[model samples]
Target: MSEKVSLLTARIIDNRRVAPAHFLMTVRLPLSFATPFPGQFVMIRNDECDGPLLARPLSVYGFQRQQDHAVMDLLYRVVGQGTSLFSRMIPGEELCFFGPLGKGFSIPTGVKKVLLVAGGVGVAPLIFLLHKRLLPADGKGIMETIFYLGARTAELLTGLERLCGFCDLKICTDDGSRGYHGPVTGLLKHDIGGFDAGDTVIYACGPKPMVRAMGNLLQDAPFHCQVSLEERMACGLGACLGCAVAVRTGEGKTDYRRVCQDGPVFDLRDIVFASPAGP
Candidate 1:
């Protein structure tokens, strides 16, 4: 019940300049706060406390809900110290956000094929689960999402052309400049072929060694992957476990999960990564 702190009223719909430190701001919110799902996150602050007074989560890239006004979208990348002070905010200037914080991205009732792996700015919360229609290509739906999306060039793959009307999108770039060249787990080990594993349901975010290499390429690929992690959080909530991680059990034993309230979304065979000075 600590996840409801509205105060939106934002506005900045498009602040381009994508690449070379990247910047793509788009805001419009006012209402729509009914549990901001789809890999939820938001907890901004660029002022009202001198400067970086904590709160700068981001993600949750799209949300509409109209009937007055309710927009939630953000795709930021300026990096270092609270987004370089939110890249010197302008275009109307009035941000002091609260969240649709933590826990989200798991609405695939029944599953047919839902692969969404992102890297670099983690494609901002999988573009809010591809616009939350929950996959509806006029087929009655139970889940059929596809999106590879990677980055390292082509200006860090900014927003991928607004997600190309949801899913079945792919792109990689390490040095080839755009769309399929190298890393993106080497284009998911040469195009996973519509992903196998009984029904498919892989989800991923980014960096942490590409979400531990998409959890070791879904460990034998029977589908059902999930991951969304990034460390260095202070307290996105879960009372400062300081973004703990390292679950991995099944007699292999290794527990300690709490990336801001039990997860930043886990279960890619339940994480493990810690090493490098070993926590």
Candidate 2:
């Protein structure tokens, strides 16, 4: 985790609808603001509004530094009151935010292949990761990158333009309106045999069902898998115990971990998914 978490204000530069019910908001940040890693997020709220008391946790979609200030893009879906308000915000309006919070995805050494999986708006952080990996500051050799994207419908899929010409992009839509006619996980499962698990790493961010299904698919596999969880967070800091997840301890016991502070990212094998309740 980054040691510096600052409470700052950003001026909205653009807020445009990208997909149906999805908006891509661009904001300008202070030049001194620390850059956030992939899977890390920010807590934001309308500075002028008094409603929606708590700040909403949003993943960093895209980031770039300019001469005088930095720019960040936040990709969000209008699901409730907070995001509904965000959709109506215009340029020059300021938003209060605090973060670069939660742990992010870490790639291990000697990995030859990288697989990025995303579902719906969960593609936000994965896009950030893709940008960094494609244009790394360290000038390291690029790995074989493959991206699997899934959405409920073709209209709801965003970021396709940015993803093209960058990696091996595969897409799936639930309604057969896109590339594959099934879930993104199913696409990955079908193509996963091409790579050797020992030197491959998988990073995923999506809804619970998609993630859970991925977990089950790779539970006994040798590939290194990490998942970014989208849990409800009241406070970005550890003080609020709102985002807790269950994991297996070394002794095979179930223990709880905080998603806000400890991770939005975790080893896929470490998570313990609860069974669906009986009717």
**CA lDDT scores, all candidates in order:** 0.72, 0.89
- How many clashes in candidate 1? 2
Error of 2 at 179 (Å): 0.2
TM-score of each: 0.33, 0.95
1-279: candidate 2 lDDT, tens digit per residue: 577887999899999999989999999998788889889999999979987988999999988999999999999999999999999999999999887898988889998888999999999989899887644655443888888999999999999977887778899999989899989999988988887998999999999999999988897678899999988888989888888888877898877788988899999998989934311
Pick by lDDT: which candidate is best?
Answer: 2
Instruction: Check candidate 2 and list the clashing pairs.
Output: none
Model 2, residue 52: what's the lDDT? 91
The prediction achieving the highest TM-score against the true structure is 2
User: At residue 239, what lDDT does model 1 achieve?
Assistant: 80
- The per-prediction CA RMSD against the true structure, in angstroms, equals 17.3, 2.4
Candidate 1: which stretches are off by over 4 Å? Answer: 1-43, 49-53, 60-90, 94-114, 117-124, 128-195, 198-201, 204-221, 229-240, 249-251, 257-267, 271-279
Show the colliding residue pairs in model 1. 39-105, 197-222
Model 1 worst lDDT window (10 residues): 133-142
lDDT of 1: 0.72
